[model samples]
Target: MNKDNLAARRAALIEQCAEQRVGLAFELNALRPSKVMAGLPLAGYVAANRKLALGAAGAALGLVLMRRKRLAGVATSALSAWKMARGALGILAQLRR
Candidate 1:
């Protein structure tokens, strides 16, 4: 009968739509992390609150200038340590490969 055919077609369409909805949900979950990172408010808030941002930057600059000698020594030590660690890591990675 015509009505039976129409009912079957409607059910098939509904099933197809449900399948598509599940696929869309999975894709959205996969994209959620990148979406959250892209939507972080820090940069936007800093742009909108320029005075606060500048004040923070100025404070940091003042601190660094006041401790220039000590900071430079620490920085040099840290850079050397980092290079050593990176070289060790590179050797480990090459061994693994």
Candidate 2:
């Protein structure tokens, strides 16, 4: 091809690329976190009660730190209870069969 035709084709391709990029950016804007969050019911509630949510989170963290040992003990007891109950249930099932 002639230089003029080659240059014209390159310019056309560049213009097409620019248009595609602009279209892609516009499409991606809808998928942004803020835009997606705005559509969620929980997001709206959290946005409306931001202070309450933050306060609750802070209180939970404080409780975990202050009662770490107690929490660990309670968790261990709960796990043992669960295991015992599971074993009992298995025995009962075998007896039924």
Candidate 3:
């Protein structure tokens, strides 16, 4: 937990790398501590937001499906009415002839 000791330890690590015939490059900045020593960051807000988004999407999809079913029924009824009207007109024309 002491910052001074931690800095000293890091310096010693870099020095040890040189002794082991390793090149000292900017890549050292990418070195991270082991997971056992470095605890993971909890993703609380991200998970909650993800669940909210998923629920919203599911509800939207359900609403769309219901609307589609209602539209299909309306379309079918309209087609039936047109067919009935055509049939009645044809019968009237035959009666006149």
For TM-score, the strongest prediction is 2
Model 3 Cα lDDT, one tens digit per residue, 1-97: 7999999999999889886654434345345333333444334443446788788889778667777778789779979999999999999999999
lDDT by residue (7-34, candidate 1, tens digit) is 9999999999999999999899877755
- TM-scores across all candidates? 0.38, 0.41, 0.32
- Determine which window of 10 residues in candidate 3 has minimal summed lDDT: 32-41
Candidate 1 clashes between residue pairs 3 or more apart in a chain or in different chains:
none
Clashes of each: 0, 0, 0
* lDDT of candidate 1 at residue 66, scale 0 to 100: 68
Q: Which has the better lDDT: candidate 1, or candidate 3?
A: 1
Cα deviation of 55 in candidate 1 (Å)?
12
> Please, what is the whole-model Cα lDDT of each candidate in the order they appear?
0.85, 0.89, 0.72
Off by over 4 Å in 3: 1-66
The parts of candidate 2 lying over 4 Å away from their true place are 38-97
